[model samples]
Structures are given as C-alpha cells and as structure tokens.
Target: MSKKNEVSFFDGKGLRNDGRRLDELRPIELEVGVLDNASGSALIRQGGNRILVGVFGPREIHPKHLALPNRATLRCRYHMAPFSVEDRKHPAPSRRETEISKVIREALEPVVFTEYYPRTTIDVYIEVLEANGGTRCSGITAASLALADAGVPMRDLVVACASGKVGGKIVLDLNDFEDKYGEADMPVAILPHLDRVLLLQMDGNLTPKEFHEALDLAIEGSKRIYEMQKKALRDSYPIPDEPQEEEVVEVEK
Candidate 1:
C-alpha cells in the first residue's frame, strides 16, 4: 500500500514494525460491556486497528429455511468503516467479508454449546472501526468474548490469532504493512481449555512444514491472548469464592 512499507521479520536484527519479536503479537486491548443495548458485546483494539462486536439472540430463526430442528444456528456479519483504511473502505460486506463471516460462525459453533438450546439462533455482528490488518482475527476474538459476556453457555472460549511469513520467516501477528508485502498468513482460533484449534485458514504461499510451524506460532500467541481474556473478564466481574456478608439472625416470637 505505502511505498514506505518494508518487509518485516528479517530486518537484519529480526525486529518487526512495532519492535515485537517474530513470535510476539502487537499488544491487544479489549473491553467488554461497551455497548448499551446489545445482549453481549466487546471491543478489541490491536495496535491501531479497532473492532467492535455485538452478539444477539439464541432467540429465533428468520427466513425459515435457515432454521434447523436438531440444533441452533449461528450467524455472523463483519463490516468495515469507510475510513478504516488508508484507501477508504466502503460500508458494505464485500465478498471477502461474506466468506470470512461464514468461517467465523463455523469456528465459534464448535466452542458454543448450541445443543443446549435446540431450534434457536445466535447472531454475532462485528464492525471494524479501523483496519490496519488482521481485522478478521480481531473480529473473531472480540465476538467470542462478547458471547461470553452475554451469559451464553459454552464449552470453552475461543481465542483467535494469526501468523504469517515475512522476509522468509514465520512471523506471529502480521501488522498492516507486513500483511501486504509478506508471503503468507495463517489465522487460527483456539479453545483455551482444550488447547486445540477451532478455526484455521492460510493464504498466499508456504511449504507444508512451514505452515505447521506457523500454526504452532499462532497457537502460542493465542494462548497468551487467552490469558489476557481471562484476566479481563475477571477484572470486570470479581466475586469471592465464599460469601463475604454475615448472615442476619431472625428472632421470632
């Protein structure tokens, strides 16, 4: 995009654009309960990019054909702001966004205990206020956290992260510039407790072995993110394991 864009990951001393090591993510900041009306919501800011997500329903299925008697349905919508990019993105769901939304829904379906609510629906809406790169991963990350905040039952929370090849080396969490010039990208979603992947996608080019290595790097990064998620949720809602208030005795005649 920019002529000043430099190939990251092997910059002689091996430092990335934001001074992170190859396997480090660009610092992520997450906030829940940001939206007033949504049933569940969260916002994620990874470096300069900003993504806000709102999850509604487990309520009902629309259009009728989309409904299933056996299990609930999961729906996702991802969009970018007009000024989110340097080139200015349109306020519509591009073809890429459509495909990504489907994948994201599939990713969370496994983590969500959908069978608990049969013949229902869950809607996850993600809006990217800024796009420096890796918005899809950020959206997924924010959506998962929002779902939990909404009091949805789930087997485990999903943490999404990405890794890619830059200057012939697998770099964890590609920033804006590296993604444009880098060789390949692999984004993944991990179930924290099980430590297993739920969503995986790769683009561009890489050897099969390199792909595996990249995946490992992404998983490592996701775990770090998972820790952050847990801390954030706890900080927002802290409860004592045991009751703190003393019970009042009642004297009746």
Candidate 2:
C-alpha cells in the first residue's frame, strides 16, 4: 500500500519507464522457417526477449513405451541459454524449464490434429537466446508458428501474450522490470480463429475487475501478434512470377 524503495515505473505524464502507454505492447518481430536443417523453425523478438523454436517429426516414437495408441504424442523442450539472462544460468535443464515445456506442449496439443498421425511424435524445441521477460508466452508463440511452417495440420494458429499490473495500473506485455516488480502477471495463449483459450497462468494478486481487464488486454495483444505470425508465414514463400510469352518470329523463320 506504500511506495517506498520501488523504482518509478510510471512517470507523472502517464508513460512507463520504457515510454510505452499502459495499453501498448512492445515491438514484436517474427520470422518463420529460419532454420535450414530443421523440419520447421521460427524466431521471434518481443521487446528484448528473443526466442527460437524448431519443430520436428510426426515420426515414429523412440523408446516405444512413450508412443500413444490413439494420437501422436507432443513433446516440448524449453531451454534458456546460459547467457540469456544477466546472470549465467546452468546449461542443464532446470525444474522451471521442464514445467514450462510441459505447459507449452499442452497449449499446442489442443490445436494440432494429432489423431491424424497416430503412434507418432511431434517434437518442439524452444530456445531463449535473450530473455527480458515473458519467455514462456513468447516461446509458445514461436513454437506454434514453427509447427504450422512444418506443415503440421492444425485447427488454427496459437497466439500468446502477457498482461500485468505495474505501478498499480494494468499494463499489456510486461518487460523485465515490470515482471520483477509488478503486482500481478498473467500469461495466456489462444486459438484466434476458434476464440478458444489454450493456455492460462497467473501469479501475484488481482481483484475480479482487474483480472478480467488484464485478460482482455492479453487477448487483444495476442490477436495483434496473430497477424504478424500469419504475415511471417506468407513472407517465407513468395509467389513466383509468370513467364511472359515470346512474340512470334514468323518473318525470321
């Protein structure tokens, strides 16, 4: 209830520390099929967060016991580079990363037509090249695009975004500073075409009204991101120009 040692997140002029409005999101850049060797890949930059996602398979599952009888199993691995954050993290997978990987897989499974590839497995790997905040949501966005680029059949593309309460005001897309100091944070993913929520997670505290407002802001942000994702896929494969017919050379012949 008292602002003491907290950093000044908002100025009197209604601008955040990064100079964005409460409802404004950081700039986002997306590219699909970025990796040549992988079946499909995508890279995304949101503010200072950078994530690369690779999708492989629909191939036979190894260790046979892990294979599903009715539908393709979805496996995900979310990792952070040792230098991704200010402090170097261990190269090995941490518990947090494992949990995030599981959540991401569940988030994507609902949209994928896994039944079409029974007894197979689709693997998605997400690597955080740089992390300022909201890596999980960004990873999910990248993974979904990568899956689509890999030619995986899906009901719809999944889009994700986060909204949080910073300086006692609801803000869309929290940066590292906001995430560290914000009172509440919520990350959500959705199937834009179906208007169905695929993932939702929250931390800290919020009232009923604030909760709905934050959720609405996140949904709007995801819709904007959806457009960029589609554009990236389209840009990856440009249409070739039609060849022009040569004029008749009857006289020469």
Candidate 3:
C-alpha cells in the first residue's frame, strides 16, 4: 500500500475511525410523513448525515411542454443547506447539486408507475440539512420512502448505500473523512427485491477485484437499508383497532 492508502483509517483489529467493522454500516434512523404540508415526506439520519425529502404531485403538469403524454414526469431537486458543512456553502444551487438531482431522479423513475398518471408530474425535493458523507445515497433512500408515503404506485422501494477502499481495506458506508481520503468510493442504488442496480457511480482508483468487492458490499448494505425503509412506512400508519361486535338482544326479539 502506498503512503496515501497506508493511513491508519482502520486499526489492526479491523475497526474504522468510528469503531465500525469493515463491513458494518453506521447507525441509521428513518421516519416518514415528517412534513404535514407536503403530500408525503421523510427524514433519515445516518451517522452525521441528515436528509429530508418531500414528494408532491401526480397532479396536472404546469407549462404543458414539460409534461409527457404517455407517463408522468419525475422531477427532483437536491440542495445542501448553507450551514450543512464546516465551511458555509452558498445557498445557490451548484453544478454538483444539479448533477446529483438528475441522478436521484433517474434512480427513482424506474420503480415509479409513471404510466398510471399520464400528462402529470411528481416532484421530489431533497434537502441535505446536514452532511457528513454518503448524503446522496441517504437522500435517495429518503425520497423513495416519501413517494410511498404519498401513495404513489411503485414496483419497489429504492435503497442506496456506498462503500469505499480505505486503509487498503474495503469498508461499507464511508464517513466524511474516508470519502475525502479513501483510495476508492462507489455509491449505488438498487431495487432490493429484484436485486437490480438502479444507479451506480464510482471515483478514485481500484483494481477490478476491489471494485467487485465494493459493489458486493454496497449491495448488501442497501438490503439492510431496504428493511429500514419498510419499517418506517409501516410505522407511519399503524393498523387500526378492530371494530367491537355488537351484543345480541335475543330477549327483546
């Protein structure tokens, strides 16, 4: 391993900076319908990364030119708050944000039943209130939950997660530090039930073997996130009480 990859990101016992095992993911907390104003909303926290997503529409599309005649259009906007990071970022949307927004939309479009709502639009907004790393993946995860909460028909929920090579070891769910210095980082979104890759992106250097290892790790991580998404949706609307049976009145009859 070169000096860059030799940093003690992981100790001899195979523990990361935050004491996570090589294949372990950071803790995650998710909730749905967090915003009353939006049709549906979700908030998710993974380690220091926090993302909020809102879904609106299945309504007529404005500016008629933007609507698709055969299917509903899906639009997504991803933004980072000015105070989300250590250095205050400008509130204006940056080029990076725009690209992320596009990818997020594509990641979700596959599962949504767009054909059911022709000439309409479904808008998804993702706000990164705080970011430590893996914000994009977490944002996509939250967006899918928000869409389901809104009652949008879908084939499956999308789940996303990232893995990277740090300290010459493949690790699941890189944090900010790992992302900045890791040898390689790969983020992926998947349709867990079908085991299909919806989105895949990578940066940095990795051997073919390492790349496959990272992909496998990311896929496993996504499955865990998929379960969490299901729990959040179920918790949002608990089962109602069963109706009580009326008493018989044999004597009166």
- Point out the higher-scoring one by TM-score: 2 or 3: 2
TM-score of predicted structure 1: 0.88
lDDT of each: 0.85, 0.92, 0.93
Q: Compose the digit string of candidate 1's lDDT tens values, residues 105-127.
A: 88898888888777888899999
Residue pairs whose backbone atoms clash in candidate 3:
none
Model 3 lDDT tens row, 125-238:
999999999999999999999999999999999999999888788999999999988888899999999889999999898899999999999999999999999999999987
Clashing pairs in 2: none
Runs of candidate 1 exceeding 4 Å displacement: 1-12, 238-253
Better-scoring candidate (TM-score), 1 or 3: 3
lDDT of 2: 0.92
TM-score of 3: 0.92
